[model samples]
Every structure is written in structure tokens, then in C-alpha cells.
Target: MQQQRWWRGATIYQIYPRSFLDVSGDGVGDLPGIEAKLDYVASLGVDAIWISPFFLSPMADFGYDIADYCAVDPLFGTLADFDRLLARAHSLGLKVMIDQVLSHSSSEHAWFKESRSSRDNPKADWYVWADAKPDGSPPNNWLSIFGGGAWQWEPRRGQYYLHNFLVQQPDLNFHNPAVQQATLDNVKFWLDRGVDGLRLDAINFCFHDRQLRDNPAKPPEKRTGRGFSPDNPYAFQYHHHNNTQPENHAFLERLRALMDQYPDVGALGEISAEDLLGTMTDYTRPGRLHMGYSFELLTEDGSPGFIRRTVEELQAHMTDGWPCWSVSNHDVPRVVSRWGQGSTHPHLASQYNALACSLRGSICLYQGEELGLPEADVPFEAIQDPYGIAFWPTFKGRDGCRTPMPWQPGNGAGFSAATPWLPVPDAHRALSVATQEADADSTLHRFRRFLAWRKRQPALTAGELRFLDAPEPLLVFERTHAKQRMLVAFNLSDQPQSVALPDLDSWHADTGHGLLSGHAEGQRLQLPARGVYYAVAPAA
Candidate 1:
């Protein structure tokens, strides 16, 4: 259980490679359909497998738009199927991590087709261009989050580039130091091909607004429930000059000095800031990013006073940094169908996924979130999400939590013998993975016994949370360390509830011994209906 900080309190299972598994029948997902589901994602005890981009793309913004940050996307396979998915995910001890997108590319990149073939190539200023103004409009008022003008033009470099999303991607101009050393040599060519880590994508859109200014308006109540939409005018402005730039913190210290030259190679970063937890506590403090994640609980809120004031403002601003907690991914909507509204309610998605692996960071689930797999109403002529076909029905994209991953209850739920690049929802074909691998109180076996008892809790893996003074829809806490403490509680309501641990004075009910045994409280604890409770703090 004390395995060299195996990514601290790790869980990470994300995978979205065009719907995770379609081994060459051409229905999409490949890499031998993720090397034939790397033993079903190493039987879901996940210590790693971040994936998400399969590179070589004109996918407009799919493989987050790279046209080859070193090959692979022949519709997702080859490089000997990503070296047999890195030799079967390092012989199933897991750890792989992938998606690097590096803030923008795919304007058919070959360095943006030689930085838009013009103004004296040597990669003509490598990308955020400009010019237009004094009459010809766009060189400023930036907007685009896939809807309007974040300045496009580029008539073979007459000027105007930027694109905060899909004007075929664009952005990348870390004010050039050979484009941040060829993007740290495409992350040292995937850590010289063994990978092991990097999620980076949109790491603060890699720099802009070198005073080619103009982002001011934003008002409809300071708009923020994260993913900007109020009829999407890119949430009416205030993106104060195209992105969070302070020269992208010296290009994230040259991408954390090329992920600190490799030993156990890590780098998470995806912080799409709008002050995202203050740019994820200044990009993971010590060495720019050994971790970073935000879209804060990927929204559709369930208020316990907004998840206790966003984990009390990320534990009063992450002191030792490290943050990563996603309640669902593949870009939102699937936290049990946006917080159990599409209800199948396996004990309220196992007490909100054991309150998202007893929060304190490093969590990531996604991939049909352990078979409680909601959100799949997909319609719009079988939409393949160009940001939900550009904001239709108010805003229904993200292909209903990026389809596919059903794994058998019949038909292509086994993820394919064919047909899958999206449509699967017959309510996730009886919640498959061969019907929750023969259901033993399945929510995918309570997420493999809540990630193997949170990998034997060193105070829920690297401790220090505090918050225990509960109330509305309850939300206690504890987590300690240097020889254990634990506690954690929640009910976030659905019906039966109660909480009075009397400051946990006589605690021992280790929640029925695994994800807090669906807590029942003979000494006072009945939580079912979005329930959850954890215990261990006794020694005063």
C-alpha cells in the first residue's frame, strides 16, 4: 500500500480514444481497441491510464486537433498499437497518461503549415499572428470557445490568428523559443516512447494577449458555472484578453523543464482557467505542474453548499499544490447522468462515488464512470460533437458523455464487432461490462471496492483535510495522517438521512469496511439516498 507515491491518492482511468474500443472494424476507437481493453482497464483498480488523444488528427478538435505530435491516429492505432499499449500497460501495473495537445495546433500543423506559409517563414512568428485592425475588424475582441471570433482570417498570413478553440485550433505561440523547443520535443517523443504521464491539453491555452488586447464586456452576473454558455457568446466576454497569460508562466517553465527530464514522468495540467482555482494554485506550485485539473466537479451542481464551498476553496488554496479531482470527464455531463437525473441510482451512484474517492485530489474516473453510466440521450442526427453541433437545443454537445464503453449486455455494448463511434445508450445497454461483471452490488463492484479501500488509506492517501462541522445535506471531514485519522461523511440528500457522530467520539463502523459500508449508524448513522460515511478517527 505504500508504493512509491503511486500518484499519491491515485485512481485515473479516463480513456476516450474515440469511444474506447473498436479494434479496426472502422467503427473508430483503436490501438487494438486500447490493446483489447488492457484487461478491462486493469480490472478497474486504476493507478493509471489517462489516454484520451490518439494523436495524428484533423479531427478539428477531436484528438484535440493535433495533426501528428508524433503519429498514431490512423483512426487510432499503430505504432505497433502504441507499443502494445505500452506493453500491456506496463504489464498491468498500469501508469500510462497521454493527452498532450499542448494548447493548440491542427491548422493542419506541420508547425501550422509552416506557420501559415508566409511573412518570411522560419515559422512566421509561430502562430498568434495579428495585423487586421484600423478598419478590417478582428485583431482583438476575442471570443471563440468554439462559437464566434477569436480572430480567424489568415488569408495566407495577411494576419489575424489566435482561436481559443477550433478555427481549426491555431493558438500556440509561446512567443517562440522555437515554439518552446518544439513543444519540448513533443514531450521528448512521449517520454521516449514509454509515456507514463502527461495530460497537459489546453494548459492555459499556451499564451496570448501580448496587448493585441480587447476582452472586456462579461456581465450577466459574472457568468461562471465553469463552461461558459448563457446562449454562448462565449459568456459575453470578460476573458480579459484571450487567455490567462503572463507569458504562460515562462511556458510553464518550459513544460516543467520537459517534465523534469523523466524519472516517473508526470504532468497533468489541463487548467482551462477563468481563474480556475486560481489557475490551479499557480499551476501546481513546485515545478509548474506535477498535477492540475479543473472544470471543477465538471458542473451540474449538487450543493452541499456547493460541495462545501469548492472543497473550502481547494483546501484554502492548495498549499502543497496537487489538485486533480473529476466527477466525470470526456468534457462533462455523466456524473450519473448529470447528478442522477437520468437515474438508475445504484445507491445514488454509490454515494457519489464514495464522495469522489474521498476527495483530497487525484481522482479521475470517466469511461462510463464505473458502469453507473448515465448521460446517453445523444440524438441530434447522431451528433459527433462539434461542441454539441455548435450549441443546439441550448447546448447539448459532448456527445452525451462521449458514448461507446458499454461492454456487453448485447450488441455493440461489448464496444464493438463494429458500429460504435458514438451511439450506445439503450440506457447504456443494461449497464454493461458484462452486466457489471455479474453484479455483486455493482457500480462496477463498488468501483472495485472503492479503489481497493482507497489503496489502504494513509489518511485517505496523503492526508490533511479538516472541515468537520456539518449541516445542509451534511458533509463532514477529517483525513489526518502520520498514523491515521480518516472520518469523512456525506448524504447530499435523496431521502433517509441523519448525522450526529458526536464529534466521532466512539467511531469504529469503518463504513461496513469498504467505501464506508453504506453507512447505517446503529450508534446514529442512516444515510442511504445519496448516502456515504466513512470512519476511523477514534484516538483523541
Candidate 2:
């Protein structure tokens, strides 16, 4: 296989730059900090590291609101520091993938500043700008993910500029050829700098309805999968006019073409739409993105049936397209915290890490997931995420998942000498890296073991998945590659369960690094709580 195509079934670890580590004693993680920890990250056995945005930004939406796509944020070190981080990671045999927020930019960006100044400037049409309605209202009924209307009035231009997120993060006008070319040019700058992959943020929001059509209303039942709190009014509509436009495909094709010029470069898109599975399929077609992931598995549901059905649906739609699965990221609550229901369960984390990696597609493991860290309870006073601050009491913001990583047991958690950007929860301290490294049965060790073992199983890494008929609390599937076939089963609940299997005469159980041991007796398989079973059969 070619080196650039390594993401086919690879596991990529995600590092939230602000929370990973801090070496400058500035209370925030920087590129030098990430460089210093490259060895530890490589030890996790992940093939690549997909870092969140570290570009120059005004911090309105953190790094997602980029002020300069090609410049490194001062808070995160200089461009030279990033070069060192990349060099260090490559030396350790880990590919580096950085975030690229192309759909929008911080209002303070030079392009946006000039575009919003006057309608006749050279960069006037660089961003999504439209005339107000007869009554001086927004151009359309589209709503912002952070709350309120998606259109913000710019008195200087006498028009409204669109912003799917916060007012400070304005959407780019991809309808303009110049805007698309400029975005592609910005991407090439990074490609020349030697990044192995790009994780495109909010990729579907690149284009909008040219006619400025009003989006139809959405019922409460159909508003759950758009990657926002149900309490947010942004979920009340179908979002037809605001995002997931057809014209975005052309832009993606252009971006992919630019990437094709550089060997071993991959593009992963973050897509969230009304029909997320269908959209993921469309966005990752042959000439488009190499892979895409949505909020399907990131929701509140973690049941066996839901997981099985979600994968089955995506597999059905994505015949030639590749899908990426992530159980947790910087945007959502930690998987252990979300699925564990306010409790910490090392067993659940172990099962989740295995299941995510064993799926039929690539995997993205978030920071601290290996430690089985639950979501921190960031108080309102400590909240820094604008999305969370906007919907405070009803839905606490994402600050919980963005807290600093706990490396040790004492104050500062070995992350920094000063008070960190976010408080390190006491619960996380109990599961710190230092503590887990000493315990043989810790989730951290289990994670490392599973990844090492998984690398040796071709059927688990790059095989076709077929789900077997199993009841609740039991997820049974088969992965086959070439002539190698393996039967994989899991008991998702805390209660013991048993499933009838075919004749066991031709099968032998393979204990996979003691993740969870299950046994077979005759034609029945016995699985304890959160148990896993992997058996191999001779080629027919």
C-alpha cells in the first residue's frame, strides 16, 4: 500500500493543542509543548495525530475562527515551532494532520475586515454578504449554531454577512471564484510545509443557497442529529438554505486536486447535516474527500443496537466512499462521561476503544480517552467556549471536554506551573497518566495493548464487516479480508450474556491481549460483563 493511503483503516489520535501540554509556563499548550510530548504520543501506537486548529485567531471560537490560515497563532508558538513538532512526529513514525477551517474565518481577518468595510472594495465579495429585507431584517430565516439569526448586520457595507457560528466567525462566500481560489492557495501553503493530512472543519458550510431561500421548519423528532443541543433553536429548522449546498462539491474537488499533487496527503472532513449519513456519503465520493465523519456515534446513544444500525446504514450508503468513526472529540462530551452516565467505568472505555478501532473504517481517538477520563464539570465562571456560554444552564458548554490533560497527581497536574486554561478535574487526577502507567490493569495499558494487538490482525484492520444477528446487550459481527475470517462479539452491558454460535469444531478462540476474556463451550459462547471474544476459523 502507498504511504499516503495509510489512513484507510488507521487509527488517528486527536490532540487539542490548548489542553495537551504546556512547556512555556504560560498556562496554555503550544507547539513546543506538543513537540516535547511526541514520544509519549508515539507510544500510544496511533498511526497519526490529527491536531485541532493552531492557526492565528482572535480566540472568539478558539482556533476555529482563523485570522490567518497560513500563520501560527502567537498563543501556540511560531511557525518554526510547528516545523519542529512536525519533524519530531515524523521522526517517531507518526504522521501529522492539522485542522483547516475553510468555511469561515474570524471577523478580524484581513479579508473579512476589508470585505465588511465597504461593498465596493477589492475584497467586498470575499465573504457571504447580502442585502437586508424590506423591514431591515436578516436576508433569510437561517439560525446560527451559537444562537440568534445567522446573518449579522454590517453597517459599513449596509448589508448582512452570514455566520453559521458566532458573530465573530463570518462565513466565506465560496460562490465567488476568487474566494475558492484563495482558500485553495491557503491550503497549498500548508501542503508545502509538509503536513501529511488535513482535517477540514465545517466543510459542508462552504456554500449557501444563492437565492437566499428560507429554510422550512423542522419537527422536534427530526432535529436531533444536526450536532447541537435540542435546546438550541438552530435545530428547529431543516437548514436547507444555510448549509450542505450542492455547489460545495466543486470546491471539495478543487481542494482534493490540490492535495493529489502531494503524495501521501489525506483529507478528512467534519460533516454535520440534516441527513448526515447521506451527506457523509456524498462528501467522500471518489473524487472528493478521502474520508468523512459526522455526529452519528457522538450522540447520547451508545446501545448495541444503535451502534450496529448506525454502521449498517452508513455502509449501505457509502459503497465506494470511506467513513471515519470518532466516539469523542473536542466538541462533544467525553465518551466515558457521556456513555457512562456520570460514572467512570474503565471497562466501558476498554470496550469502546476496541469497538471503535475494530469498526470497518478509520478511527479518531480523542485525547485522554485512553485514560478513561470522564467529562469535567467546568463551572459557569470558568466557561470559555462561546457556544456553551450562550446556552449555559440548559446545556453546559464544551469546556468540560477541553480541560487540561492530567499527567500527574498533584496541582497543575504536571501540565503547567501557572493555573491552566481550564481546571483539571479531581476525577481526572485519579486516572492520570502517571497513575495508569504504574497499574497493570488500567484502561491506559489496556488501550495500548489493544492497539498493538489490533495491528497484527489484518481482518480487524482492513476487512469488510458483516453484522451477525444478536439480541440486546450483544453485538456480534464478522470481519473478513482475503481468506482470513474472524468472528468478533461483545457484551455491551454490565450483565453476563450468552449467544448461540455455529458449530465450534472449526473455530479456536484467540485471546486478544486480555482486553476482556470470553469463553466458548460447545455451541454456546459465554461472555461476562463488558466481555469481548475473537475467534478464527480456517479458510474454506
Q: TM-score winner among the candidates?
A: 2
The positional error of residue 453 in candidate 2, measured at the CA in angstroms, is: 0.5
lDDT accuracy of residue 373 in candidate 1: 77
Worst 10 residues of 1 by lDDT: 512-521
Candidate 2 residue runs with Cα over 4 Å from true position: 1-3, 342-344
**lDDT tens digits by residue: candidate 2, 1-540:** 145588888899999999999988899988888998889899989999999999999898879999999999999999999999999999999999999999999998999989988989999989999898899988889999998889999999899999999999999999999999999999999999999999999999999999999999998777765347658988889988889999999889999889999989899999988778788989988889999975788988988899999999999998888889999999889888787664444588998888898899899999999998888999999999888888878788899999999999898899998899999989888889999999999999999989998888888888899999888889999999886788888988887999887775467888865688788988898998888988887645
Please give the clash total of every predicted structure, in order.
Answer: 7, 2
lDDT of each: 0.78, 0.89
Q: Candidate 1: TM-score?
A: 0.35
What is the C-alpha lDDT profile of model 1 across 279-377, one tens digit per residue? 788878876777788667778886677877888898688776777788888877778767666555457776777787777878888777777777778
